[model samples]
Target: LSEIYPRNLMRKTAKMGGLPSPSEFVKLVNSSASQGDIQIDHVEVIAPIYEKWPPDSHTRIFLDSSNKTDEPVYAREVLSNFLSRAWRHHATDAEIDQKLALFAKIRPKCDDFQEAMVEVLATVLSSPKFLYLVPPGRAKRSGKSGDGNRLAAWELATRLSVFLWCSTPDDELLELSARGRLNDRDVLVSQVKRMLADPRSRRFSRHFVRQWLGMQLLDFLQVDRKAFRQFNPSLKEAMQEEPIAFFDEVLKHNHSVLDFIHADYTMTNERLARHYGLKDVYGNDFRRVELDSTHRRGGLLTQAGLLAMNSDGK
Candidate 1:
C-alpha cells in the first residue's frame, strides 16, 4: 500500500495537468533527488543551542539569582536591544525603565525569570512604537508647525525595507541609518539596487502585481468542469503566477513598462505553455518564452487566467 502512494499521487497530479504523466513525475523526482545534482557550497550557523549564556551577557546576569546587583543592568541591556530591533530605533531611558518596571512587577507572580521577561517583551511587541511606522520626533500628532514634516534616518530605513522587501530592515540597513549615510542620494540608489538584486525583492513584485492587477479574482475563481474539460487546477495556478513572474522579468531587465500591454514574449511553465498551445517548453519552472503570431498571445490583456477568472464559470 505504501508503494502505491507515490504512483497514486503522481496520477492525481498528472490528471490535474501538473505533470505530463506519472512516469515523467517519477523521472523529475528521481533527477532532483539524485546525489550528483546535490552540492554544499557553504554552511554558516547563525544561532546555536546554548544551555547557558556567556560571561557578562544580559541573559546570564538575569538568570543568576545570586547576581541581584546586576539585575537592573541586565534589564536595561535586554530592553534596549529589544527596542532597537523591534521599534527600529534607540529607546529613551524612560521607555526602558517603564518596561523594566513592568518586568519587576510581574517577576514575583511568574514561575521563572524567563516567563516574567516574556510578559514584558509582549508589551514591547504590542506597543505602537514597534507596530507602526511613526517617524522619530513625530510620535505625537500636533497641529503646530514643524511637528511631522520630515522622516528620521531610522524611519526612512524602515519604510524602504517594508516597501521593497515586505520585511524589517536588515543589519546592513540599520547600520547605515545609524551612521546617517542612507539619506545620501547616491548611497540610497546603491542600496535600492542591492535590495532589488536580493531575492527578497520578489515579495515586492508578487505583492505589487497582485494588487495592481486585482489578482484576488483568481483566488475566488470557480470553473465548471463540464463546460471546460481541458481546464485544470494546475493551469489556473500557473496563470496566477504568470503576471507576477512577468513583472519581475521586466523589472529585472529594466524594460519599459509599456511591454506589459503588448510584448512578443510571456512567462510560462510547462503547464501554462500547453494551455496556450505553445510547443517544446517543459518543466514546472517558469521562464521567459518568445511568442509568435501563431501563439496569438502577448500580455496581461490576452492571458487566459485573467479571462477565466472574470467569467461566469462557463
Candidate 2:
C-alpha cells in the first residue's frame, strides 16, 4: 500500500488513476493547476533515518574521553563498550587489553583510526563472543532442574529475545535482566507482553510457522503448473506467503491455534482471491475474507500452494 499509494496521498487521488504521464502533467501545468511553492531553506532529518550530527553513529564509534587524543585509550574504551553489547557480557579489562593490543598493532599499519578499527571489529564478530549465545548448564527458561541451577537474568533475557524476536535483547529487556527482575514471574509476564507487542515478534511467527508447518517444502516440490492454469511465478510467491500470513493473523489477533485447520475467514489478496475464485477483493494487499462452506476452503489443506506442493508434478 505504501508503494501503490502512500498515506499522504500527495498530488494523487483514486480518480486520477495513478500518476499522470509526463505529457499530461505538462498539459496540466499550462492549464494552470494549483500553483504553490513553499521554499524549504533547511530540513531536519530525524533519527532512525538521518542520524543527528555529531551523529549517534559517530558518537557510537568516537565516544567522549578524558584523553581524547590518546587513540589507544579511546580505542580501549570503544572496544569495551562494543563488547558489552555484542557479547552480551561485560568485557573484563584483561579482555579489552588483549583486543586493544591487536588494535594498536593494526592502527599504525592503516590509513586512519576508523579503517584500522574495522579489522578489530571484524575479529570481534568472528570471535565466539559474537558468533554464539551459549546457554549455561541448566540455565533454560523453565527453571525446573534436578540440579537446581537457574539462568542469570541476562541469560534469560537473551534467550527470550532470541526465541521470540530472533535477535539480541533491546535496551529495556537487557536493563530488566541486569536488574535481576527477568526471572520474577510478574516481570517476566510484563516483558513477554511487551515483546509480543513489539514489531520484532513478527519474526517469531515467520520462522516458527514456516519450520513447524514445513512450508519450505513448497520451494523444492514442482507444481503441476500447466494443470494448475493460474499457478505462475507471481502466484506461486503469493501461495508461499499464504500460510505465513495466516499464522501471523492468528498470532496478531490472539485467535485460536485451531484456526490453522479451521477458520471462518482466510487471508487473501487480489492474486489469491482470483486464484481461489474468491470475489471482490482487489489489490496486492492480503486481507481476511469471510468464507462459507460452499467455498470449500478454510484451512491449510485447501490452500493452492500446499495442494500444489503435495501434488505429483504432472
Candidate 3:
C-alpha cells in the first residue's frame, strides 16, 4: 500500500476487470460479496495511521513554544507569526494589535487560551488583508507616472506568487519586493526568471493546461472498456497528466509555443506508451520520448486521453 496523500487509490481498485472502477460504495457486513479487492465480509483493517508519536499535525499547530500554556504571553507571539504568514508576510502591527485585543476579549468567555486564540485566528484569516490582494498604492515613480496602477513591491510579489505558484510569495521574493527595487526592469526580469525557475511554477502549467484544453470533460466521460481494453484507471490519470507535463517541459526550457502543435517528443509512461503502440518505454513515471513519423503520434491531438475523451468509443 503506497502512502500517497491522494486518498490511497490502490485500495479502492476493483479486482474483477482490469478496467476503471464505476462501482458505488456501501457500508455493510458483506457489501463486496464476490470482490477480491475489498472484503466487506472481513473486518476492514486500516493501515497504521500515525507513524510518529504526537504526530506532525499536532506539533505544527500546537508549536513548541515556551508560552504554550500561558495564553496571555504566547497569544501575541503566535498571532503575529500566524498573521504574517496568512497575510503573505504583509502583516502590520495594527492588524496584530487588533487580533491580540480580540483574543484578550474572548479569552475570558472561552474555556482555555487555545480556544479563545482560535476565535481571534479565525478573524485574522477572514480579514481583507488576508483575503484580498489590496495593492499598496506606490505610484511615486522617478520619471513621470500619475495613477499608474503599479503594484507595490510586496504587492507585485504577492500577485506573481499567486499567478505562478497559486500560493503566497516566499521569503526571498518578499524581501526583494520590500527593497522597493523590484519595480526596476532588470530586477523585475530577474525576479520573474527566478519564479519561473522555481518548482512551484508547476502549478501554473497544471492550472493553465487544464483550463486551456477543457480537461474537465474527461472527469465525466466513461471509458468504453469493450473498445479500449487497454484503458485502465491509472491510464486515465496519466492521460490528464500528459498535457500538464508537456506544458511544464516547454515552460522550463523556454521552448517555442509552436512545439505545442508539433513537438519532436511526447510525455509518456509505460501505461501510455503501451496504449500508443510505443516500444521499449517502461515504468509508471512520465517522461518525454523522441517521436518520429512512423510512430504517428506528434502532439496534443494524438494524446490518448484527448483522443479517448473525444471518441464515441466505436
Lowest-sum lDDT 10-residue window in model 3:
26-35
* Candidate 2 wrong stretches, greater than 4 Å: 1-68, 138-151
lDDT per residue for candidate 1 within 29-126, as digits (tens), equals 22221113434475443433355555344453244445445766766777777777778776768888899998898878766656677678888889
TM-score of each: 0.70, 0.74, 0.71
Measured by TM-score, the strongest candidate is: 2
Clashing pairs in 2: none
Total clashing pairs for each candidate: 0, 0, 0
Order of all candidates by lDDT, from best down to worst?
1, 2, 3
Q: Please state the error at residue 67 of candidate 3 in Å.
A: 6.3
- What tens digits encode model 2's per-residue C-alpha lDDT throughout 1-314? 01122233355433213554342221111111112334447545344444456767577766778967888877888898887767765566877888898998887777777667767877888887677887666332443552222236667887898889988788898787766778789999888888888889989988987788788777876767678665665577778888878887888788997877877889887777887888998866678999988886687778877787776657
Error of 1 at 187 (Å): 0.3
The model with the greater TM-score, 2 or 3, is: 2
